[model samples]
Target: MTLPFPSLEDLVNVISSTVDYIVNIVYNTIRGALIDFYNWLMASIEWLLNYIRANLPFVISVVLTWTALYKSVTAENIPLTRRIMNILTAPLFSMFALSLVDALLPREIKLPRYSYPALAIASVYAETEARAEYIIRHRTGYVVEAEAETEARAIYSLGS
Candidate 1:
């Protein structure tokens, strides 16, 4: 005789269909989220690549200008007037340099592959500043050179 509930076969079929419906819903949700994330990441990279391609010439000009300004200002053989011009106009180049460094540089002290030119420019600026300070304070280049030599010797010395 049949019990109060439906037949066992019908009961089994209903349970199976419910489980399949739940699994499909969950799977579709997860897949849609992953697909959307992948699409967003690809779009962002594509936009960046396009932006760099369009602005490459301007970026190169800025880098070259900053490099020339730095080298000219640091060179001792260059005439004082030209050096001064280079130094004064340095801030213009520096605006670009500063922006690039701030936007591109990581927050760590370690240098990345793109930081070589920035490092060189910074080194030149530091050297120029130090020499200027020494000249202003001592009124002589010889004294500064001598002091640098002494500092180097002290640093390299092994004695007590």
Candidate 2:
């Protein structure tokens, strides 16, 4: 007599087909997301490259300005003369380099004439403020203590 239930072979085939369908769906979904991500990444890179190429002079100017700001601000523990020189020369050199780059590269955008100088001035102001705050916080207490000790010694000597 024939069995009422499906045969083992038929059951195995159904399960195998179900697993294959699920795997294909998952694989296609992951593959599509990866392709989209790759396309987006490539497009971003291409846009960045084109922007840099088109605005090479402005880019150079910005880089030079930031370099000058960094050099001037980081010159903290140096001698007065050296610090002055650093503060002065960094911006000058940056401006000169920017000018050179502007001349050398074909520009689609022009950097403002006053931008570097303004940024330099702002950096100097920031450095000065930092130094002032440091002195106020770190040196004021020592100065007050030294003066008090000197006065106390003088008073003792006079009493003796």
Measured over all alpha carbons after superposition, the RMSD of each candidate to the real structure, in angstroms, is 26.5, 29.0
Residue-wise C-alpha lDDT for candidate 1, range 1-160, written one tens digit per residue: 8689899899999999999999998997776566556656665665676666556545665776778787997798999998888867866776676566556644323111110010111223545553312111111221221234434333322111
RMSD of 2: 29.0
lDDT of each: 0.53, 0.54
Poorly placed runs, candidate 2 (over 4 Å): 61-160
Candidate 2 per-residue lDDT over residues 16-60, each given as its tens digit: 999999999899778656655665666566567658766776667
Evaluated against the true structure, the overall lDDT of model 1 is 0.53
Candidate 1 worst ten-residue window by lDDT: 111-120
TM-scores of the candidates in the order shown: 0.44, 0.38
